[model samples]
Target chain A: MSDHKILQYPKSPYLKTSYYEDTAIQAFDTPFRKKCLVIGLLFWVCFPFVASSYVVHIANLSAIAAIGAMSLNLLIGNTGLLSLGHAGFMGAGAFTTAIMTVQFGLPIWIVIPASGIVGALLGLIAGLPSFQLKGIYLGLSTLAIHHIIKYGCSEYQYYGGFGYGIVLEAPSLGPLLLAGKTVWFFVLWISAFATALLIANLLRSKPGRAWSAIRDRDIAAEVSGIDIGFYKILAFVVSSSLISMQGSLYAYYTAVVSVEEYSFGLTVSYLAMIIVGGLGSVLGSFLGALLITALPYALIILAGLVDLSFAVKEHFSVIQTGVFGMVVILFLLLEPLGLVEIWRRVRCYFELWPFSYKPLTIIKR
Target chain B: MLLASIVVLAGIYALLGSGFVIIYKASRILNFAHAEIVMLAGYLAVSLAVAIPFSAASLLAVLCFCFVLGMSIYAILIRPLAGYSVLSAIILTVAVGVLLNAVGVFVWRGEMEVIPFGWRTYFSLPGNIRLSSIEFATLGIVTLFYACMGLFYRFTKIGQQMRATAENPLLAAQRGISIYRISGIAWGIGFAAAGLAAFLLGINYAISLQIGNIAVAAFVVALIGGLDSLLGTIPAAFIIAATEQLTITYANPRLGDAIPFIIMLMVLMFKPWGLLGTKEELDRV
Candidate 1:
């Protein structure tokens, strides 16, 4: 009992207990981290200028994927919902933007928000089943919704005489035409950054805490007076809205809205992105989006480097799918926590210096 | 003609859905890879028929191979994931399906092929309708399989042990029953059923990668019949198969693909445990 006195003493000299310390984003919590962030921002800002148009285009695509990935992570990682209908949300946004732009002649700004509203409505419908179903059952219901939405989209195209799908004019924002790789890159990456900041802050707030609580244990959360159904629906609405907005941007970027693009495969890829990135982490979402979006290009380059035979090249899509499966399996089996865990381990190894031990305390003197 | 088609389609759904139900009953995990198993069996039937001299021998070989493959999938991939969340297990099954699909594409080159077993002759029915010989074989095979399974479950010691394991795994294990072995047998039987169904489907139509979509319809069947009850799949399959046929024949051909999903959503909305599924099963999931 006397020895227990030593355990009661302050374990670390650098202990922080302020509310601000608890809620503030960890990336900017320390001076060194802030400096690293500044450097990263500078790199991000200069990337378009330094790289070619094709590279900028890829970056823009990654940024768009990053937005979708982050929103999906919010639902699956934070809320524990496991939705397989993310691509449907994105498609709804794309088609909404298409109809608003082509038929009603609405501006890009108006169309984007309209798409988000449509997404929110759809999210409500999608999330309603979550009240009664949990885990994989909820996922299946979302999948059913996805197929329904896909059918509706295709039927609209078929009836509207756009058999090939609707193509839109380059979107203009007021005086400036929002075309070309450079301008869209800025628009997209900035939106991605804003989304990241928004989600990071949201995760620190009451709703975010409620979402995590529900995700960890809904019945326990219910016992603690949390409205389980409300939070679950809120998660779907928010996630779908963001993903739909990204879809709007995607439609504008590609200048096309087609049902073929929003297949079940697309939803699987986004799921892969969040899972591969680091489920609940914002930075992990960005990393995962970048990695998965670039996987095909990376595979092509790798195939070129290896000088593979023409037979393998002919079946490249098949090989790509096989590799995708292998990557997901390896990640789930070996590193279930994802690329973010790898980054944390590397940071820990460097931060710990010559001491080859993991610190038991959160803070060190 | 409509009745004959409905009967044949229902038989196919019953075979596949019962496979899904058995697996879920044993381990409480949804086997998303069941579709891939069906696809693989079709391909195997096509290729092995060309390689082997005897058609019946090749059919047996395919079933035997699929049984082993199913057990291997359980032992290698799914067994490790038992400790994780059910979502992870589901995702792993999807991933395995993707891998198997890629392998199938690589081996078969994604080409459509006909199964050589069935004679393509049509028998005239009493009402100016024609049923293919393959359709007759399908109905006969489905009936025989169900009858055998019914007797096996009631009388066989291994089947009784499996039933015990499914009812209460902990108590079964305490009584010196090996839960893993029972689960492996369930997977084995499930895969064998899928293989037999795929053979019938390939002979009736043509074998291709697209045949995997049949599993989605079967998935709806499993849900409608209750995921835990094997007998429930028969009526559930009839309901789904009739809905699918009616929609395709009367409503629109395009809506045929979407009809099953629409019914599933409606069922989930009103009867989440399914038409025959126990209420407690919903809470357990």
Candidate 2:
């Protein structure tokens, strides 16, 4: 217990209770972390200025995913809930934005918050299964809910024989019609950054510790006087709201709200982001979003540069999927602690220079 | 009478559920890619049907191929992941499913293919109820497999060994039960069941990528029946099939996909252990 480094939540003067800061995310307040954050922020801010429009587009996509991934990390990585229907919330957000904006002529500012509310409502419904179910049952129930949501979305899409999806006019938050690449890039980056910070702060708070307590052991958490059910639902609501907000922004960015785009595949990618990055860490979520977002483009570059046979080039799409699956498998099999664990090891090695310890250092800590 | 629809639909779902049940019983790892593998085997059969003439012998060969494929998948990819968390392994299966889906799109290119199953006859009963020969055969095949599985688990040496391994892997290993062989057998049978369901599905309609999504409904049925209970899928499948069939008949057919899921959620809310799932499973997680 002496080794545990509790987070200092500035506003919450009531909580003197502390828990162990066991992951890279908890070390976020360190001096080295401040330096890294500054450097990372500077790089992202200057990134669009030097990069081409295509690169900017990729960054925009990564930024949206980062926000969504970080939100999901709040639920899955921190709260220890396995939700397979994250896309349901994402789709809900997008549709809320589209319906409010297109049908009621609402502004972007109003629609974003409305979408988050819708997402939180849906999350409450989805979170119901978690109260009575655990593990596989909970996962499947979420999946079923996701399918139900998708069914509703498709019905919306095909309603009145439209034969297609809803298309939105370009989003404008007042005088600015955010159609330009540079403008979209900055707008998306700011939203994602703010989301990351918001989640980080929440994770360092009392509710965060309560969520963690429930995650480590629900029975024990209940005995410790935490309202396990309330906190669990709260985790879902907060995470789902943020995720839906990302979805709404995505709709505005793409200017389209198609049900087909929000499928199980989309959910899988978000899960991949959190798992590959480090489930509970905000930085891991960001890293995962960037990696997964850039993965396809990287594969395309590799394919184009290599003088592969025409047949191989034609089948590159499936090959890329195989490569992606293999990478995830390797991570799960070899490094279950994820990239956050790898990052910790690297930092420790540098700090200890000549006396870097082995995996057993985890226990010694 | 919609009894025909219920019987045919539930039979297929029952087969699909067994695929989930067997692997879960053996390894305790939920294979999210179960349906995808099932879809792949169906595609394999369709491809073979094109190259070689369809016959009972050919069907057996295709199922055998799927069994081998399943064994290798477990041996090569999943076995190495035994050291990781159950959630992580399950996530890996999700990745595998995505990859398999990509392969389905790559190989078939989204076109619907039919396995020339060569069984097109339908037997009609009183009251306008009709059963396609393939559906009838599927019902028979599933029943036979379940009966055999029951006997195997109750009376055979390997069956007892499998039970031991599933109950306590570490203790079973010390007691001379081979986890490798039991897991292999479980995956093989599970894949075989999936292949049979896929084959029947292709014979009834056309095989398409959407088959995987429909097969996902099987998970609902299985969970409601009980994840670990081998025979529990029967009653759960019937309940779901009846509900879905009624929904299709009385309501907008579009809601058919949501019916089973709704039932699953309802069941989970009331009886989380399922109809026959052991009460202790709630604590295992």
Candidate 3:
């Protein structure tokens, strides 16, 4: 077992909690969990009502990003495939939605499914390289593929009379035109919530179990009669399709689909979401998406509240990115389990009350 | 003449490509921050040049600084996570790259060309071949530096330890090799090499956020050569550079950036480990 270390997940020093399955050892399956979930849903449901239009816009973005981060988390956190091209998948979905709705005059319902198919097909193309590539090699191959996709889209936009960007004519269902920030907020939140639930259930099911097995040890997973190739492709397919679906919705929400929007920065933000939120947990992805999506606006608001130097204001965007990078690096080095673990420890500490103590088993395990 | 120009670009790539190959060979992590380190080196050298008022000495100072800086990063950030997931290390480097880019933007702003070394643009050689002296100097320096590196890796005691550690760190540790020191050395050499490439590139043209994209090109080179095979990177660098040159010359200049990646995709599909990369070492991940 010691010799087969690659097959085992690296036990973090701080948190030894398993990412997917909740083991009985923790005693976390309780009324408290249900209570928290209920509260969270209520918070999200009431968010648009209490919040300003700008806040609703941010919520809509976060919800869209949550769907993306969840899809990426499935690949990176659950299946252990590292991709630098998450933005590309999202962009593919967005572009597909744009072209379908604008050119073919398709309804939103029809466009979404078509985008999902295109995204899945593109995912298959991306997955093609993964058959041979592993770890860093796979990551780079995906980066190259991302660049190609980016180049293709830009080229298409340039020649196809949509050089600036393809703007979707506001989506509609017969009489009901999907318009306004609040309406889009509800629409995005529903899909994001649905996807989160689906993934939470799926990860505990057969294919998710297969993915976890493959991630832990592909060789062993194969030895154990898991269809490793099938699961890997399935993970990519599921991840890409959902990402595309989010992009399709985003096309309407943002009302703009352009290559510029889906830059490397977009990829990094999605990565930041997954890493910050916690890798494997659906709840983590959702939380991560919200935190990151809201962060820049919060920064801007903070900047306004506290008067900044003229010099600092000149390079504000660069400073923001630098701060963002520092935050991510700090998290990786200090709190690799991310926000979920932080939340868990706080809850556990409160539950333990005045006698907050550590068991020696965690250190020695 | 076009072939000569391709060779010149290849020569520069050989040096740039080494940035990826060196760290990858030892630690098995692709240092994505390398391009920024290259850009950083250029800016550092420029600032030093301004401060010291001596070009040659400042350049050396910048290179040495780059060497120590790389070693420090490995010791502080990378070593702790060595035995853990490769994915974490990879993303860590991405963060490192982003931070470095932010620093670069803050220091130099968006786009600033290198104050080119005198002798300016192109110099016409005999036989109707045009040679840019700065480019030729870069080619000469990079080739010579790599030649020394090749010899050092082949003949030196530390090099032997590096190779042994790369083969299997646990076994190397069992054999009393300081995996930490060897990896630090790998990073030091890697950064120093990248610094040299950056300096040469700055002399030839502009250094900006765009030059960071060259790291992707270098990644393509490293991939083709086999990530771990330093010697393999030599010809692979030239071939990739030449391919890029040919594409730019014959096809669209925009397409030039993508040709190596298209080649990489095809290679990964057929032969994933790369030209001279060790096969069995792959499954360890």
Model 2 scores a C-alpha lDDT of: 0.83
| C-alpha DockQ of every model | 0.51, 0.52, 0.46
Model 3 residue runs over 4 Å out of place are A1-42, A354-365, B50-53, B120-127
Off by over 4 Å in 2: A1-39, A354-360, A363-365, B167-174
TM-score, cand. 2: 0.91
True contacts kept of 2: 0.55
lDDT of 3: 0.83
State how far residue B136 of model 3 sits from its true place (Å). 1.7
The local distance difference test score of each candidate is: 0.88, 0.83, 0.83
Model 1: residue A109 alpha-carbon error in angstroms:
0.6
Residues A303-334, model 3: lDDT tens digits: 99988889889998898888788877888888
The best candidate by lDDT is 1
Model 1: residue A48 alpha-carbon error in angstroms:
1.9
lDDT of 2 by residue, A292-358 (tens): 8999888998777779987668778888887777677777777776787888888767766887355
Which parts of model 1 are misplaced by more than 4 Å?
A1-14, A360-365
What is the clash count for each candidate, in the order shown? 0, 0, 0
Error of 3 at B127 (Å): 4.7
Q: Residue B260 deviation, candidate 2, in Å?
A: 1.4
Docking band of candidate 2: medium
